[model samples]
Target: MYPSSALGEFLRSRRARLQPEELGLPGGVRRRRVAGLRREELAPLAGVSVGYYIRLEQGQAPNVSDEVLDALARTLRLDADERRHLHRLARIPQAQTSLPPTEVLRPGLSHMVEAFTDAPAIAVGRRGDILAWNPLAHALLAPHWPVMPTGRPPNFVRIDFLELAFARSLYADWAAKARDDVAYLQVSVSNFPGDEQLLAFIAELKELSPEFRELWAEHPVSNCATIAREYRHPQVGAMTLAAELLRPPDDEGQGVTVFQAEPGSVSQDRLRRLAELTSGSAA
Candidate 1:
């Protein structure tokens, strides 16, 4: 079929938002019957025939040309992210027979995590899969989990949005923080086109929340080098933490993210106390 379910949904979403009147076409002087502009209307707007547009929409078009895709993008007035998504869906190659696990932490990177003894540090792949995390990192991040799973990868993006108590309780600047996190993840997705896992994760998020779909369409980018975050520590109360993202040497495919509270501040005090409470809990 088409690369994934996301393609049909993406096109339909765009098509459902346009109007013939908006395209400078006659509104037929009669009431419109369709929810959005019909395929025939879009074909003329995109400078393509209705039959061809129908084939494209129905997932029957094979090896769709970039020029035609660009024409459709222009006609739809797609934003940068939506245009990129269109291109991605149309061009995603077949999955490899033996695709390797994208998450793997290097030794030197592991050492860096250890070096940040007091800071909460985590190593994540391009797809946001947590490959490794330091002790304090676990303490800063894991309070959200109802029960910590043994030796399993935790998806940071999923926990942020899906976990009700965690998003509401732990994160203080929740909306802004969520947007930044999603923007960062989008950048990673853009960097690695045709990564099946990344594509599937984006598809999953798109289905899970309309807000995410809207944000993803905006195509924001965040480097994650530094961020201001507020965390409510069950033990020490609320603390604002400065998040840091570190990319190791070229050989390492993963990046390390550390959250540190300002020294001598209330957040610092809370982080220290919380760290003490979970001292030996790291598995």
Candidate 2:
């Protein structure tokens, strides 16, 4: 389902976003009947026939080649992530069968999370579940986590975009961040066509939020590495935190996103003090 229908949807989404004028085509010649670029127009741009593009979108075509996929991605102005997704969909030699359900975090990973004292670290599964976190992680991400206890593994994607109050209070640039996170998740989902939770999550998000629906239609892949996020903390007031993501070699889905402040800065000092006050309080 992922590498098959998802590719079609992804391509269609990209085509729907651009205007004739944006693509340097005549805009006022005739009243457009459709919502997005026409198949004929896109076919030429992608160096394919109208019938071929139509077949690809309709999932009637055979496996797409890398060269053709790259051309389509370039024509659609895809980013690094989007391009990779295009390749992924094209290169999946075997037809998609049924995918497995989500896997819960292991106990050893939970113990590792519990051992972290000052660092705000959490073990997130492939689908972005909270999985496990130390007290400091809970304290720092409390704004995003809501009242759901650590064991329940609250999903950050759902919390940020769906829960209006939590999103507005926790992140000033909520929409941008949410879109990035969504795109990231989409890329991950595309990578793992055998992930059932990924498919279900995409379906649910598409149904629930109009903004998410619109953005999902674009099919942009979110692969931006570094971002400075502004957090309006209840205790520390307002501070911009720079986040760095570290991926473990053994686990493809697991990664540690560590937050830090600028050197010799008050925010840094405050974070250090906060760590001192609350570090290693096992409860």
Weakest 10 consecutive residues, lDDT, candidate 2?
A: 143-152
Writing each residue's lDDT as its tens digit, candidate 1 over 1-283 gives: 2244445556776877877788887768777675677888888878889998877776677688999899999988887766776786676554634235555668777787778877788878777767777767777787554333656478787777666567667787777877886876765654455566777887888799776777776555456668887787666788898888888657233788888778889888778887777785643
Per-residue alpha-carbon lDDT of candidate 2 for residues 153-264, written as tens digits (9 for 90 to 100): 5777777767868777878788777877777787777666777777888788779978778777766676545678887767766767786665666756666566777888
Best by TM-score: 2
Lowest summed lDDT across 10 adjacent residues in model 1 is found at: 92-101
TM-score of each: 0.63, 0.84
In order, the Cα lDDT scores of the candidates are 0.72, 0.72
lDDT of 2 at 100: 54
